[model samples]
Target chain A: MSANKSILVCRCAERGLVDTDGIAGGESVLVIPDLCRAVADGDPMLGGAFSEVHACHPRAVQSLFRFAGHPLPDTTQVIDCRCDGAGHAALGTMEDKPPAWYPVIDYDRCSSCGQCLEFCLFGVYEKAPDGRIRVVNPDQCKNNCPACARICPEAAIIFPKSVEVPINGAEIDDEAAVRANIRVNVDEILGDDVYAALRARKQKRKALLNRKKIERALEERRKCSGGDQ
Target chain B: MKMEKTGVHGIPSTLQERDSLRLRVETYADQQGLVPPLSMEELRDHALELAPSSVSVDYVMVLLNNAVWRETVASIPYERRLLLLPQCLRDFKNCPAEMDEFGLLCEECGRCNIGELQSLAEDLGYVVLVAEGSTVVTRLLDGGKVDAVIGVSCLNALEKSFPHMADGAIPGLAIPLNAGGCIDTTTDVEHVRNAIRLRSDASWVNQVDTARIREMVEGWFSAIEIDSMDTRTEQIAYEWVCGEGKRWRPYLLACTYDALSGADGIFPEKVRRLALAVECFHKASLIHDDIEDDDEVRYNAPTLHCQYGIPVALNAGDFLVGEGYRLIASVPSRTADLMRIAVENHRMLCVGQGEELRGLVDTPPFTAAQLIEIFRRKTAPAFGAALRLGALAAGGDDRLDAALRRFSESLGIAYQIHDDLEEYRSGEEHDLRASILLALANDQRPLEWYAPDSPNLDHVFREMMVEEKAAQLLEHYKNEAIRALNPLASAPLKSLLRRTTSKMLTPAGGRA
Candidate 1:
């Protein structure tokens, strides 16, 4: 049954790293590390593995398939899932997780107008069981879709600064060895004094970052203690 | 007067007509010493005086555009010049390129002259756009990034953009596309190159023939000469060094030294050694880089590691690097200062490379800014070192040293960004290892497109946007490099450095 279903390949879902969640249950979703590599290798068996393959970037997929030595199967579909909310259901997840931006209502300035609820098409808002409008599905709120915020007549809505989500589980391989190689290579090409100067600049940057971190922590502590009063 | 010289679309267009018009304009300028910022009425009168009865209004408009802009274009800095090319210049059938909001993303496959023109203009620090009509011209004018324009388009599009240029008071020279079907059109390539190199000091054009410098540098690595030292390693090193490459680094070194000393002849002996040393270092880096990246080919030949095996290649690379240092040490003038520059830049280069390698294991979603920072660190230092070595060889003072460092850093980053754009256009491979396009795509595109296992995306709009941003950044850095030259008192050296900045971006055979 899963083999008969269409599998959507959303490339931007995880910064082109990996998206295991797109493999829903037993659905025949194949996650290739790189389309160019897959097409270059041209595994003939791939042509018949799935009923349909929908990709966010169809042109690239088509080019890759062509490069792979065969035309994309008739069942292949390319969708415009960039930011227009198309083919999102098949992809099974939104691109930006932990949603970098969401609407926040200011109760003090609010006149309790329901304009935001009407304007939002993504079901990001709902009438609560208690009959008051509230943010029920914040995850459904598209990243940087500020239409609802703009349409708010009361001007009570605000979006916080977008947080830069660090890539998870990413680690530099043998940082010290890499650095040592760099030093050795540089010393060989330039000379020892150049290495010393580079080191000094690096140390200065590190010290500045450390100082900033300490200052931020101290400010946070001060705010926390001040709020206690 | 019959309109005998008409185009396919009945527009009065012919090569002879255009040439005669250009000849008259040049004659007028020569006779009258007419610089740009001329009134439209004055330009019209001049055109009428040249060809009162036969020339069409379109030809007059073009002549006017040239007359009103030539001197202004010459005076404006190269970084402030924009080359507006029409999409029709592209090979319609063979081009696997796409259009963005700003313009066409040229693949630069050399299928058409657009690639050559774009490459040349960009090398000269000109912002090149492959789009027709007035839209981008108006935007570029309003943005204030471009001070002058050299546009190639049909008469229709040129007329459309004329009002916008006039209103903005922007100096512009328009070269009408040779054909008028708006697809697969051609332009006089020689004329375009001449306009691009039209600076106030025409004598500066081809002042340092890079080909000559390359030939001279090649002699330094002669196998016979190197083998005379009686060592197998020296022979191998010489062979590796003498292999086919652009030799841009050595050229930069020699150019800088010449600019500083105001010497118009072959580099003196010490400067030659210094220039050769710069190449040795660059070639050595390539060898080790190939091994690290596991690349098989370079300059269309087997990489050092691939040819000689990793151990021997590594040793050879190390030996070349040592030779670079030795060469610098052997320079007669201010060897200590030269060594300092070489060592410092080498370290910076390593740190930059280390940062890049470190990124591989975790493969962080680097932003464009971060990638630019890496470019600055890794690529800029080599250029800086080459420039400083040349400067020091010419007996440059501390002030020049500081200026060269700043200038090279900016030039280096801009150069790398330009390379990234070129690589993206070539579509040879989808290697986004250190690509600014990928960084911008990651930062701007929706989350779903960021998946590690995702297919290569061809979002033309995003690519164009990123390219626009990168061009702005490139312009910013180019200006910074120019600014760094402000401290220098010597006018020739200043002009030479400016010309060098232009030369650095240009590929071989880019100039006329």
Candidate 2:
């Protein structure tokens, strides 16, 4: 069934932002282990199989589907269960492996280019014996640093929790989206030194940002004031 | 159903992917003959084929649209472009900015990326707006306040705003926030920085440094005496030429010429003659005005008539007038036109002074309309001639000439009022000059109040609202001057005129 045809609930097994205990369970209601993780992991249950979503927030849940390559139809209503008397969700199962915050490869888009493997400073990816690149240490990936993903040649890497779309797994839909999102060519700015460049970006953003205003003001004063005279 | 896959929603995930996709999209757009403003459908088809299957049509469409518009957007002067940023980009938890009807008033606190981006765009001359939604965008575009936009928003919001861009085909580039929740949204800040820095090969954007131009014009007057300061009259004329006046008339002439000249912005030698002629006409009028008004002080020195007596001062003034004609007649091009301007302006000025000398034997010492007419006739012609001569040298078109005429008229009247307000404080005695306040006072005062020592002078002036009326006229004329420049197409000349207005009338903020 398409997502719009049934009600969906995420009994978030861990964070418990929502609880499914009192929800009416019927053919019209569909329950999920966790929408965020299900979307992140490419779980088949997230397919167009529900009409309504009982999630933390409509916008957050809607984005979760976008990351999973299946956007929620406009016809579906997302019911927020994060507040009110919605008690802590109990999934009645053991907590699985700690939530992964690593890059997920979109195999359909990956051209086996090995760009990610070469770009990773940490052992996030490795050359499999079959001569294919694989995520060897997903846990080792840096948190909130999607630098490696930005350097992807085919935009095939997904950081499900990232702040920007495409990287966060939302589809690019319009010119505005395209203009806002640019895959930067690291070679152009830092001379192909991805490792050093990535490391320096953090520090430089601070250092360079400090001087930008001062430099611009001096330049503007000269231009506007018509020079020292 | 096909095997489930996470993360292949179509936008570029990695910078490398994005970079490569952009190049491919450019090539594809060219091959497909896809012009900019290729509607969403056209972009979709090409995007699907050109971008990686994993990437969405919208991702590739950005490349395609930018490929076509990149040159156009870059070519627009930064002064004409608008930078539209969403307020949600702020760190709502820590942001201290306030929102007005127009948009967020950024505090530049550095708590969020908006501050850095705003500073960068503003430095390049963009009008920046940090707001939510497309309302401000529509208003700005409709009002012709901007030519292009660099906008950032979330996908959900983009859905609403993108239609405006696509429909108008208004040249713009958009960046969507990575995840959607109005709070704590993120984007590639570096990407934004690059977009703001984009420029075209227009050489003039970097030209016309105001101070450099001011210094150059000042240098021209400082460098010479009239071949021979042989006679006493010659010496006085040269001395008056180098007096402590601001040299604004000549500066206006040179700046106008520069604005309309070649992109290299060279100050041609011939312009010196034309500028000096302008100064001559100005000095000659000041000399004669001092004789008529019997002024004792000018440029912080004794009036020419006071120092040299009316006989010699009158002769010296005639000599400067002759010199003005001589200088204009010497310039090779537009000699006839320049001479006509000088003579016509000189005539209007004499007529205005003639009215002043005849006396305001009317109901109020002088009617406000009659005073304004006197100011317009006396002050506006000199400024008009200066600007017109400069423009004529540039081979300016009829529209430019008309604009210059309108601009100079308002500028002249406004400037005269400013001077009057400065010289005549409220409740002060009216000098021999035609003062707006005197006219205003006459409008309210009883005939007996005209007595020299009328005790209620200050009270009558206050009750009449003389100061406020004069200030309003000054402000009204200043705005009129600005409005006159709107019809002008030359960006440099418009900018120069605007800067000139600000320099003169900004103090007319006559809180007086």
* Candidate 2 residue spans exceeding 4 A from truth: A1-229, B1-89, B94-112, B115-195, B263-265, B360-364, B422-433, B441-455, B508-512
User: Each prediction's DockQ?
Assistant: 0.01, 0.01
Question: Residues B307-391, candidate 2, lDDT per residue (tens digit)?
Answer: 8899988888899889988888888887787787778888998898788777544333676777888888888887898888888
Worst 10 residues of 2 chain B by lDDT: B1-10
lDDT digits (tens) for residues B122-176 of candidate 1: 7777767775334444445432234578988777666556655543445678887
Error of 2 at B333 (Å): 2.2
Report the Cα lDDT for residue B196, model 1: 84
Chain A accuracy of model 1 expressed as TM-score:
0.28
